[model samples]
Target: MSTVYLVGAGPGDPGMLTLKAKEVIETCDVMIYDYLANADFLKWCKEDCEILYVGKKGGDHTLPQDKINELIIEKARTGKTICRLKGGDPYVFGRGGEEAEELVEAGIDFEVVPGITAGVAAPAYAGIPVTHRDHTTSVCFITGHEDPTKEKSGHNWSVYGQSNSTLVFYMGVKNLPMIAENLMKNGRAADTPVALVRWGTRCEQTSMVSTLENVAEDAAERGFKAPSIIVVGGVCSLHDKLGWFEKKPLLGQGVVVTRAREQASGMVKTMRDLGACVYEFPTISINPLENADEVEEHALQLGRWDWVIFTSVNGVKHFWQHLRNAGLDARQFGGINVAAIGPATANALRDRGINPDFVPKKYVAEHVVKGLLDLDIAGKKVLIPRARVAREILPAELTRAKCDVKVLPVYETTLAEESGAEIEKALEEGRIQYVTFTSSSTVENFFQLVKAEKVQDCPHVKMACIGPVTAKTLRDYGLTPDIQPEDYTIPGLVQSILDDK
Candidate 1:
């Protein structure tokens, strides 16, 4: 039987997408997505999956409802799995029910996947809880605009006005005056609280709160437009105390994360969720090795070494890159030593079908040296293949202890040239709220790509360096480090920012 899946794409953020929606998007041969659906969500699709954009923007749908239904049916009939991705819950204010009816008439097999609806999600993101113990127990969610072509039907606003229930209206900006008037006529208090939230989940979210009597005027003063929702009743009063999103220290500030584009995903996602605008600017690009000579040389000499050290996941990745490039397997390191400087780097080795022989309790290079010296390596060999700019402390320590150390520069760190314009633009416009320096080279290389005058433009922006070394490097650029974490991991850096905030 032909099958179709009606999936909710969540609010604007790609991270908000449901696991089922992500799974369906990956497996489906065809996908029809909404205009409000985030473009990043489409990245989950396989390389060959057919994607059709059937979005509705501001009530102007690119494809008519009937045409969308016909397309789904046609796609399913071809014996391919079909996915219909919609913004928010597929059924809430969406024409998903109507489309489902057509699918049923066409005898298509289908399933509905519910999503975090924007009506509720947006308010939560703004730190306004719809239901609180002290707040009203009942909540009403109604469309602000009925079919404009139809005669406006009168709803008894008095029931909602007299009751203590919270009232939430979707698509309500167009009928703000009428909604306020009806509430006032129906016994709603003139001073009842009201709030308008625009572009709720995304970075562009703006909100204004006022009493029911003056909400329309307040919205007008703030230039509130459609694609915004209205929340009325006493819960709207809690925004000041309960508002969390806007309270982020760097809220609305724009910062650029300069990790490699592939590796930058985690940092970019974290910063954006913390209520800051993030631009991706990769400072370094990674290229895999083309041959197995390096991997074979290290693997074949493994048994003679007392410790084999990996400092970064990229080091582990590139090592494996050479291993695969040379057609060698994990067994090549038999009886040889394995050590990782950090937990993340150690895990990378475990993921690739081998366990690290030794991992330092502390993740620093000094800790790795201490751990290695404690081992039996009086006449042993140690292989340390790492980034070119790594500190020589480890090799120097091993040699002083009378251990033979073979050092190979498997990867060279070069200044990335792609970040010139973006950093300058962000600096000139005063958009950067934070610039985190993870390594001394990253600090130096970033400034090398961008000129000295441009770097000085963002003097007031908060600067975070991962450690004392990176912090010193920032001082050379004529800026002081405002936040430096005790531990230099990415998560530690984020926690430091949160703590200082």
Candidate 2:
């Protein structure tokens, strides 16, 4: 039998999309989505899959209810994998119940994949628990919009009003006046706590708190728009203390970090935990060097060298790959001393069970050179296998110390793919609140990926350069840096963004 999967598109963030939802979306042949469904979530769909926009936006309806229903049935009949994706929980405010009923009447096989509803999701994102043991004992889910053509009169507010349950209304902004007045008329207190959450669970989310009698007016004053939720009852009063999303360490700060993907992973995890959303735009993509015949041929000659130095993790990785290619392993360095430029590179070597004998306390190339000079290398042989763009100071200093040093280029740097559309769309829609540039190369390469034509039109999205070099690059690109760290490290850049606030 044919199937129509009615899946819920969780509120805004693609991260909130369930693993099951993501898996099905990846395999679906065709996906029908609403305007409110997060577009980023659709990126999970197979590249060749057809996407159909079937819901209304603002006052314009792309495809009416009847047309959308017919489309789903027709697609299912074709034996294609059809997905009717909706924003939030389908059965909640989404006319999903009506659509499912229609499908059942027509003898169509349909299944609903529940999603995180906006009413519950919004409050949770704001760090307010919908149910609290000390406050609300029960919660009532209600609608804000009622059928206009339905025969006359207000809903029986008394039934829910007297229950003392926390009432949450979905799509209730437009009819707030009538709903509030009717509730108060029945038995609900005018002073009942109410909250309006707009763009819930998203970076742009905003909220306002007031009493039942004046919530509508207060929401309007705060400019709450559609795709919002109205929650009522005592639980609303606890938001002031429970609001935690806004309290993240790097909540509104934006920093740019330029490090290789492998090296950048640790820094990214650290920044994210501190409440900062890091935008990864790698300036220099690392690629293996063109010719390594000489480096590979001299692999066992490592014992002839007094020291084998690695400047970056890429250096360690590429050198190791070459060693394996030549049927050599960590044991080849038996009599040779090992050195790494920093702790990160040292850990990379240590992971291979070959701990470096020495590593610079500081991470810079100059520091590595200074530290090596402190060690006795007179009349000794040293091997430095690193990136083509890596500094020559280490080898030069070793030579100055009367040591024979061989510099082998292990990897090369290249620019990453263009991100013009992403940056442009993010700026136009205000999706990206901040951007971090970790290196001068990243600052230049990111702009190269972005169309300069659109940059001038972008609104006030904050820009942060990780260091002076990156800051100068941004200035050359006709953009002024908002935050620059005194130190050129990932944590330093992150701290700079936080310090700005």
Candidate 3:
């Protein structure tokens, strides 16, 4: 059955997204979203899903409201599941009701999924609770700017001023001065506390506190614009004591990740949680080798090999799947010893019910090769599962130690085909503060997508490489690494970026 789900995409932070919202988004056939919805949510969409942006910003409407309703109706009739993603509550300030009514009249099956409205969430993130027990008991949400085409104003300033309840105004920056005047005229105290939160709950969030009497003039001097929330109440006084999100150390800093799409999720989430504006520019794609059957063939002879070494996380993953394809499990590896180069690779081995017999202290080739050489497995048959193209140090060192090392190409890493416009624009404008490269492949492929000259043009955009090897690859491109951690891992790389700041 075809259904249209009206989904609330939360205010701005992607973490505020509800589990149900994520479920519907990933499974939907078409996702029709607007400017208010966070772009980060698009990553949750499954492959082959259709994404259409009808985002309306200021007076620039990508598609008229009536046309959006018609599009939803037309998509529903075509038997395709549709997800109408709106920012905050779908029913808050937009044409959500009109669209719902249109869907009802069209006899389309639909469901309404609620989201965290900005009025509540923005205030909370700003450290100003809209309804504190010490302040007003009631709260009201109002649109600061109404329809420009309306002949008459429907608002009663008297009721609003005398209500003595906390008032939150959406899209009210431009009309804040007038709103403040009207509230004071209608028996509201001129000294009432007011807070203007711009881009609330986001990395670029900024808050300004002022009294009702001088707020308008102060806003004019400070240059506050629309897309801000106007909180009017005694509750706003707590902003100085309670504001936390804006205090984040990395807030508003832009960092780009050039890892493969499959492996960048954890790194991306960590940067976002620290209040850095993260851009995922995946530069490579990991695919199984064409001779994938060779992995299964090699798994069958696991009993003959004295040792097995998995070099990368991708190596561990693909090798295990092919091992399973051969109808063999971890038990088949019975007496063969395993070695993993890094903790992540070791954990991947552990997940498949095989803990590595040896894991080096450092992920570098010298440390890993030395640790295995110290095991005194000279002349032993060692099967190494890794990418088709990788550093030869491990195997070369093993061979020198008289160990018979045979490399099994389990996976291939190829440059991904993706547009470089976003990253180019960010670098050109000096907006991106850092570009994080997790591997030599990411560094090499990143330059393939974004020109070296463009990076040279933006000296402010420093390179944060995970390890010395990746740093050397970046240096080959004529760019020096500004951040390289002593420990070669994602958490270590993130700490180095923080320390660099």
Task: Give the number of the best model, judged by lDDT.
Answer: 3
* Best-first order by TM-score: 3, 2, 1
Which model is ahead, 1 or 2, in terms of TM-score?
A: 2
Q: Estimate each model's TM-score.
A: 0.74, 0.81, 0.96
Give the runs in model 2 whose Cα sits over 4 Å from its true position.
Answer: 1-4, 13-15, 26-32, 42-62, 65-85, 95-111, 147-154, 252-305, 317-329, 377-412, 424-434, 451-463, 468-482
Q: Write one digit per residue (lDDT tens) for candidate 1, span 1-501.
A: 657999998877667888998999999999899887777777689889999998777678899878999999999999999989998889998778998999999998999998888888888877678887787887888888776667766456778667787888888897999999998888888999898888887766778789989999989988999788799887888888777767666567676676766567877878887877776666776654444466567755566666677878888877776667567777766777888877678888899877987887766667777787788754578888777667788888878888888876566666665848867887888877777777777788777787867766667777788777778888998878899987777888878877866
- Those runs of model 1 whose alpha carbons end farther than 4 Å from true positions after fitting are 13-15, 59-79, 105-108, 126-137, 152-164, 201-208, 223-226, 261-273, 278-288, 317-380, 387-432, 435-487, 495-501
**Candidate 3, clashing residue pairs?**
none
Alpha carbon lDDT at 487, candidate 2: 64
Judging by TM-score, tell me the better candidate of 2 and 3.
3
**Alpha-carbon error at 438 in model 2, in Å?**
1.8
Error of 2 at 146 (Å): 3.6
Weakest 10 consecutive residues, lDDT, candidate 2? 251-260
